[model samples]
Target: MKSNLVCRNRETVRINEYIHMPKQLSPAQVEQFWNDGFLFPVDAFDGVQAKKYRNLLEEAERDHPGEIHAEHRNNAHYILKFLDEIAHHPVILDVMEDLLGPDVLLTGTVLFIKEPQTPAFVSWHQDSTYTGIEPKEGITVWVALSEASSESGCMQMIPESHHQGILEHHDRFGENNILTRGQTIEGIEKERAVDVTLKPGQISLHHVRTVHSSTPNRSDDRRIGLALQSFIAASVKQTLGEDYALSVRGQDPFQHFLRARRPQSDYEPEGIAFREAANQRLSDILYHGSELKRDY
Candidate 1:
């Protein structure tokens, strides 16, 4: 059964409005998030800043395209200064801290790019299903680097789906499917899905267990978005194996994962080495028990 905020599912507990928390989001917005398992249009970057970041990404993509593809996309922050800064952005962290408490650990980041007119699409799935992170108390902050409109195939999520807890998923790994395993949850009513559209500078926050997906980009321009895969409380731990994360806020006395650091610059030698090791560990966690291990 549902309470005031979110359902008492395996991933997250109920959070009431009366509790003392940060004020980045208004009371009503927070209520919507709890009730819907997501919130959007959170202003985090200015237009110029967003454009600049986008430019930076494109520049790197043009310069060293291979580094940003496949599994490398999982943790570009380890070697890309822009991605590092984006992952540690204060505004996004503030929202995370407010909802999940003071201590926040950024587990990973995923750079999503849907090329114009491409068949790339994300199947319906919950973020926490394959993550191996327990307590499921985390939020994904999807920051748009370009316009995220329906035409651009913005994220579509089902309200209160997280209440069902961790549902079963099948790995189809379909061609054009952007997900590693093409992991999906079947039998969702399309009409009930809500399109999370955003401007270049805007961002959306969604519960880890929330069911979400995106269609192929139909817009003329490349659809770009950076997903801060998860920001969890310092108390959270990985059940799979050795893990690493960045301490974004407050104190992390738990030390559940190894310390992750910032990238000195794009494709820095030291940073790339760290990223490779981190990705190898994260890969083991995300793709455990699966025979079909993808490069990305």
Candidate 2:
């Protein structure tokens, strides 16, 4: 489970027999991964760092409120500007590079903030479906900025569900639920569900195709998390379809969006198109969200 991989030039790369310090995974952990398609307790951020990011998120929320888009809200793309000082400290880079290999590109980021008494709940589905990529090579690092537990609607997954590949998604209704648009899947059990609860700063890593979801926050405390999805260095490609805001350092904002194949045939093409358009529209609405921050 130990890796001799070494990072070079800010890009992660593998070196054989180099014995360079790298994150080590145990045989049992690897086997569990092979069976469950996910890993947990890899490394967690410190409280100070978590609080720093939490404050930043609060500020953003105060400024933008409901104006932020799905992609741009919570400063997802601009994390590096404050990541070192906030969360995802250098300690995480080792495990990330170990799992994703060198030459990594952060493809997606999300902040799951479950406020007290909110009925929001994420539907069961694989992460790869939303990512515009192929071959399903990516890692989702879910860092708990606050305490996460089943009572507060922690994440749950079906062990070894990734091996089943893409499963049909069904429409689910609730407070915050997945509108699967009336799709169904066969050969899967609803009885097998594992809730993943972590203390503040703890993290969980899962394969892109792993089936996962979370329930609403019914507890009094808010459950906040920052998720960063990283892929191998070779996964970068110019977006060919819709337009999205990208925050590459020292470059113009990324306005081009790419469209990749849907993981399930039941995925609604019209819904996808509407989501893309809505994202663009939201970006326009919050165009000044980042402009107000002179230091970000």
Candidate 3:
């Protein structure tokens, strides 16, 4: 279908207050997201813009090679500062509203770089465990800047896994599921794993509680993705003095940021509240962990 959203020379689109999707999501797709807690192939960024962002990331890596983690040699650099330009992007806001409703807050931003030949594997787990958010209804939009496929270590998810509620998790490098409060859940069928492959610019939106993971890059091309997680304000509750903490750019270290959504029908309240809550929560949890300390 032709997009009414016009692009400026294929690199960027001029998004104003009137942003809307050329095609509204079908009722089935909406139900799928609600029931399964994930959505795939939602247009957030286009090819040209993805290329531009990729170049920016490459430059960041080149200038700051030291910033690249040793264990993640295949992994490079990332940043997540506020960008009014992105906030106004039509496709982004459109999908944000569709999934999160009108009241969506920006919780956290991450730029994941998997260099070629990197053997780092992200174990299966739920994202809400790390965010420390209550309700755990947040949405994480993963935007692929390059062609991501199973051969190149794309993401994998368990179908309808979120329906199982929070599962038991272990720390990637530690003994207990540092963020899971030492709790564990049984009954995950490993045979149901599904790999996600996508072309450059394609995006996937999943719930914070969804069981997901990614393999190391075995492909020659680098695998890069920008992850933006959003939530509704009402779903976020403060959790301070907890064993686990959520770290952000400028805030003191604290444990967990809850993901929440405004009542589904109240769009305006949801959007405004989410925006404010995310800013505070992200600023608090953005950079908790230090640089990578392993050799993949």
Candidate 4:
């Protein structure tokens, strides 16, 4: 057992390699996730593959500036082949199938990156606050393409907060906030927060209603994470307007929303239309019931 595939970007990544990393959660681990609302450090791939994907992402940023910029960051897989491949990754989906059952649908992805020494941060919020899905069984599988350490402002979760069942949230639309609506849940116990530090190719999965946020990056390297969000059970239906998702796994008998296809290339017609419809509906859903309307 010499090949641990340590992520070179962080000293702790190598230190953590000796520990057992399972592609799928154990029964006991599964119980803990339900009880705690979040689980982390699930092995999805090796650091070598992670580095390759990182390079691909940076290359895209350099070559095609606006393609993955702004709101495009939300559904990046529509334009980038690597992101699409990552979305449909078998190892990651195996873990998803374990938690979400055989019939899984992927709504979209969000690429959150914190530049070194930047004040950019996500406010405390539950994803269920915006995503208008019923039954609330959806999960967000956040995959780290780079080192996600405490110094890098890794996500911090309020354990078992999903049990609180979508607490009240207010919108700030703050200057440095990275969230679409700058949505925030007030009054969290900081003493109870758990830092979800991860290394390249590792992933953290959390319930849709889990309360979470991140601090600003203090480290020299940019912290990059691809959130494969809204992995929902086939039985769940959209409570808001029309939405779209790709059936990444088994059959979807309910058919709550329109089925989206993987883009053949960057900015193709079908993909563009799919993204426009889904994103527009998402905006309305997230901005629903807000008294203060602000440009996001």
Q: lDDT values of the candidates?
A: 0.86, 0.54, 0.54, 0.81
Worst 10 residues of 2 by lDDT: 1-10
| lDDT per residue as tens, model 1, 274-295 | 9889989988988899999888
The TM-score, computed over Cα atoms with residue i paired to residue i, of candidate 1 is: 0.94
Candidate 4 local Cα displacement, residue 137, angstroms:
2.0
Error of 4 at 294 (Å): 6.5
> What is the per-residue lDDT of model 4 for residues 97-201, given as tens digits with 9 covering 90 to 100?
766667889988889989999999999999977788886668899999999999999999999887666688778888899897788888889789999999999
Model 2 alpha-carbon drift over 4 Å, by segment? 1-21, 24-31, 66-75, 83-88, 171-175, 178-188, 236-296
Worst 10 residues of 1 by lDDT: 4-13
For model 4, give the 10-residue run with minimal summed lDDT. 1-10
Candidate 2 achieves a global lDDT of 0.54
Better of 2 and 4 by TM-score: 4
Question: Each candidate: how many clashes?
Answer: 1, 4, 25, 0
For each candidate in turn, the TM-score is: 0.94, 0.67, 0.65, 0.88
Q: Which number leads on TM-score?
A: 1
Candidate 3 vs candidate 4, TM-score winner? 4
Residue 23's lDDT in candidate 1: 56
RMSD of 2: 11.0
